[model samples]
Target: MLKGLIFDLDGVLTDSAKFHLAAWNNLAQELGIKLTSAQLDSLRGISRMDSLNLILKYGKQENKYTKTQKEEFAAEKNEKFLEQVETMTPADILPGITELLADAKKAGLKMCIASASKNAPKILSKLGIASQFDQIVNPALLERGKPDPEIYQRAQQLLQLHNDEVISFEDAAAGVAAIKAAHQFAVGIGDKQILKGADYIVKSTKELKLDKIVAVFKRNNKKVG
Candidate 1:
């Protein structure tokens, strides 16, 4: 049986990734660093500091900013992101997510969120689902973010569940990689090509089937032990 569900917040629970992209892109433009949409997409699911560093490295703008300057730029991006997110409503919940969460909770599965966003808790609160999760592991508590497995691992530990007892749902490549790195089964939600390594891929959260997720967990458990 699947004992827990670990979710990635931005793209999975809410459609806030676009706001993040906009914030970053706006900052990059102000800094005189031109970033293509493709480059911006690559930064998804990464921490603000890491994303800024990557942008600096790739844009060859590292020499232009001191550590303090970089921090200021990152702060500016987050400010814009928060401003945009202030407009989020319950309607912003991803398709089938409310139903999925309700079903999972009813099925006796513990739920948690493992996200790179520092504002995850607030977002959940705003959505009126803050109390739904048993735990929430976000960037604020971690030294690193997605693709590093720290946040996911922290969530697993907090939930007191083994890897086999839980499944991760993610939409970004970095999130999928982190879940897999932590030796957990991952359900990807988004472009199939980018989510090729996911144990299963669904076009949206609406496509998620609880029975199928549980069955996969059972099958994996049997194979492992």
Candidate 2:
């Protein structure tokens, strides 16, 4: 019985990758670093600090910055990202997300966001869908980020639901890893190969139907049982 749904905000709900990329690129340019497209993709589903470390390492300057300096860089990037976020409107909600939220509400499923972003609430509100979620797990409260189960575990706890009663939607490999690690059903919303660990995969949210997802979850749960 899938009683709850956990969602990753960025790629899953709306495409914030452009905003993130623009911010990272702006910061990289300031530091005289050039990031490849592949490098930008790798930042998905990771914390701000972790992404900064990866960028610094790629630029061969990881050893050059103190923790405080790195924090400043991350903060600078976030300010730029927030500027983009501020421009978001309900029109920015991705395809099928509005339909999915309506369907989930109709089905009486509890919903929450389990994201690496500290800006989850702002993003959701800007998309005009903040009222749909029961909670948005605060990444800052967790000891670990995506690829670790802590964030999802915290979301599940907040939802007051058993892990087996939840299905988590994610767009990144790390997010799928976290969902599975938390003993929940993992529905990946991206390339199947990249999110191979997921119990189910859809190329995009537009393909998601509540009834179909429930059917799949039950079948998979039975097999696991």
Candidate 3:
């Protein structure tokens, strides 16, 4: 039986990713680092420092800055992003997300947010859904980012559920990889091809149903670590 549900916050819960991209683009432009929109897309499901590292890698100029400077850069980008998202409200909450969260709670499934964003608390608050989650696992407590499983593992641990009894919802390839690495069933939200690693795929939360999610996992019943 499914005992818990862990969600990736950015694209899965809301539409704040655009703000993140804008923030990163602003910083990149200032630093003489030309980042294509495609390159900035990779920042999803990664930690602040990891995102900074990816940007440096894209620019092929990691050797130019000390680790301290990189940290500062990430902070600056986060500040810009936060400013852009400060006005978010319940209206900003994604369609079907509220219903899913309500259904998960009613079904006795523990629910949590496992996001790479360090500002998860603020974002959830802005969306007026902070109280819906049992726990929020951001990048602050982990040594690694999404696609590594550390964050998801911690989230499952927090929920006190076995890997087989837990499942995750994600929107990015890296987030799906993290859920699989954590040995849980994955429900991908987005294009099917990009989310092939997931056990199940739905276009959006609007089309999701708890029965369908459980059915997929039961039929598969396979661990994928």
> lDDT score, residue 33, model 2?
91
The per-model lDDT (C-alpha) reads 0.88, 0.91, 0.86
Model 1 steric clash pairs: none
Worst 10 residues of 3 by lDDT: 216-225
Provide TM-scores for the models: 0.96, 0.97, 0.94
Quick one: ranking by lDDT, best first? Answer: 2, 1, 3
- Model 3, residue 32: distance off in Å is 1.8
Predicted structure with the largest TM-score when compared to the true one:
2
Task: Report the lDDT tens digits of candidate 1 across residue range 73-157.
Answer: 9999999999988898898998888988989989889998898888898889778889999998756768877798888889999
Error of 2 at 133 (Å): 0.5
Give one digit per residue, the lDDT tens place, for model 3 in 1-225.
779999898888898888888888888878888987668888877777888888888888879899889888988998888887898998888888888888888998888899988789999998989998999885776898889999989999999999898889998899999999988889999889989999999998788888788888888774432
- Ranked by TM-score, the better of candidates 1 and 3 is 1
Q: Report the Cα lDDT for candidate 2.
A: 0.91
How many Å off is the CA of 38 in candidate 1? 1.4
